[model samples]
Target: MVKTKIAVLVSGGGTNLQALLDAQREGVLTDGEIVLVISSNDSAYALTRAAQAGVPAVVCSRKALGSQAAFEAAISQALSDHGVELLVLAGFMSILSADFTSRWPRRILNVHPSLIPAFCGKGFYGLKVHQAALDYGVKVTGATVHFVNEVPDGGEILLQKAVEIQPGDTPETLQRRVMEQAEWKLLPQATQMISEEIRREKDQ
Candidate 1:
């Protein structure tokens, strides 16, 4: 069985990346192997995590590039150079261009901190999603793994798991719970689903 080559894009600490790495090591990712880790920020600790795991890491700093197009091009080139079959956005902050999304379509996946459509869309990301959910007083908040499209968080949902919002739950606390319970679990499961589907298709 051929394993699909996956490239993870990150901007910060890469907790999600770590989860995927752990899953891959445990053989949970199933027919998908994380081949490369790319970061939009040079100082992102995600690169360090990838290096520690003995995975190739690359930096395509958005700040260093003159334009958004250039930055997108660099990312695209990196994916192509690595022969990535799937792209996973793990705490990656940069908004990819429509051209890039169109090129990849459902081949790209992202794990958002909220169930989406409630604490999602433009201007809602990272802790902001949890903050908005907390401000809205939602009793249940969770994570979502969805295919990447042109619109932000506007894609076909693959998996979602709700995390109960306890009393006195701050955004930080809620974020931690969601990451531990939902994001970590759902991302790997969703990736495995895609990988298995690809394998089945190839077999047929």
Candidate 2:
């Protein structure tokens, strides 16, 4: 089996990145290979996770660039240089430029903390989604792994795993639960789907 080359983009503690690495090392995620780990924030713990795993990690900052386009261009070039076939947005916080999204099209994937199309839009991220869920008394909330389009959080859905919103669950509790679910299943499942899609394309 040809392993798909993937680069994970991160901007914070790499819990998800570590999950992916663990899954791969354990043969739970064998269809693809993590080629490089890239971070927008130099201080991001995700970079440390990559380093400890012995994976090549690079820090590319948007602040250094004069514009978002320039930043995207640099990152795009880096991806090309690394021969990355898939872009996994592990915990990246920046909104990607349209030009960059056009360049990669459906090659990029992102995992959102909510069920999507519901608790997702501009300014929805991190603990915000969970807080909103609790405030609104929603009975359910979950994680979504989807393809990223030019617009923010407006991508075609690939997979969604729902978690029940128990009463008295704080934002932290809910977020932890959702993350645990995603950690065990989301990344590996999405990678497998991408691998299967690539195989089908090759056959055709």
Residue-wise C-alpha lDDT for candidate 2, range 1-119, written one tens digit per residue = 77788899999998889888998999877777888998999999999899898888888888977678778877888888888888889879999977778777778999999888888
Prediction 1 global C-alpha lDDT: 0.92
Global lDDT of each candidate? 0.92, 0.86
lDDT of 1 by residue, 102-182 (tens): 998779999999987779999999889999999999999999999999899998999999999999998899999999999
| Steric clash count of candidate 1 | 0
Compared with the true structure, model 2 gives a TM-score of 0.94
Each prediction's total of clashing residue pairs, residues at least 3 apart in sequence or on different chains, is 0, 0
Best candidate, lDDT-wise? 1
Looking at model 1, the pairs that clash are none
- Which runs in model 1 stand beyond 4 Å of their true positions? none
